[model samples]
Target: MVPPTTGPTHHLGKSEIEYYAMLAKTEVQHYSGTNIELGTACGKYFRVCTLSITDPGDSDIIRSLESA
Candidate 1:
């Protein structure tokens, strides 16, 4: 599905959906109004959303920090 912001492609797999559901306490929304509302809800209630961005992952970053 297409979202308003199209700068990057977000690859959400089944595992990611389950994970996000656990974090958000709600499933993802598709419709614009509801999607925006969910975003607004997240903004208001949750301190953060722990969604991952970037391929090859950031495990190296954490490893570097620990070594320092």
Candidate 2:
């Protein structure tokens, strides 16, 4: 996978690195919706204080939140 490029501000940047790292190291079960406290869970990624996708479609939204 390509390394993530740095963003303009330090706090807000591409999640490619984090996502891929989670993809590689975090177990699928850790992502279950029941585990809201898990950092890798879908809920954490969608938390309003965090981030949002641009122009995401229905399937994209599902793919982002519905996956474990």
Candidate 3:
């Protein structure tokens, strides 16, 4: 039989979601007014995005990290 996974499913809270959003390179917004209100306090620092790593070598590096 298959064994259980290491940990329970942990849902990301609004704060955690915002945290990652801020780390992203673009603006992150939610349609919900509640999210807007909460995220607003953080100022414009919070946003949605990604860095352009066009170097093909990066793919190999990413794969290595995922395997690790």
Candidate 4:
């Protein structure tokens, strides 16, 4: 599962999604793209500041990200 976050909310230290993810010790992947780009990649018609990839499936997404 991937959960979205807003830029302002995160910067203001009021992002509940980020807080919960930290508590759960989950890895947070920061997309080096704008909110609109992130949203587009996720197939959403909105903005996305941040996102957590809970499951990477059978792909080498994690490895590729690390490499990048």
Candidate with maximal lDDT = 4
Candidate 3, which ten residues in sequence have the lowest lDDT sum? 1-10
| Index of the highest-TM-score prediction | 4
Give per-residue CA lDDT, model 2, range 1-68, as digits (tens).
22223223134343544665577763221122222233243345532222334354564543544552
**lDDT (C-alpha) at residue 63 in model 2:** 57
Off by over 4 Å in 4: 1-6, 13-18
Assess every candidate by TM-score: 0.22, 0.19, 0.26, 0.56
Q: What does candidate 4 score on TM?
A: 0.56
Sum up the clashes in candidate 2. 0
Error of 2 at 24 (Å): 0.4
- At residue 33, what lDDT does model 4 achieve? 61
The clash tally of candidate 1 reads: 0
Runs in model 2 with CA error above 4 Å? 1-13, 26-68
Which TM-score value belongs to model 3?
0.26
Residue range 1-68, candidate 1, lDDT tens digits: 11122112245554565565668665332322343453564355522223332342644633432364
Order candidates by lDDT, high to low. 4, 1, 2, 3
Ranked by lDDT, the better of candidates 3 and 4 is 4
Q: Which residue pairs clash in candidate 4?
A: none
Candidate 1 error regions (>4 Å): 1-12, 27-68
lDDT of 4 at 10: 56
Candidate 4 lDDT, 14-40, residue by residue in tens:
456566678887655556667887788
Question: Candidate 3 has which clashing residue pairs, if any?
Answer: 26-48, 26-49, 27-48, 28-47, 28-48
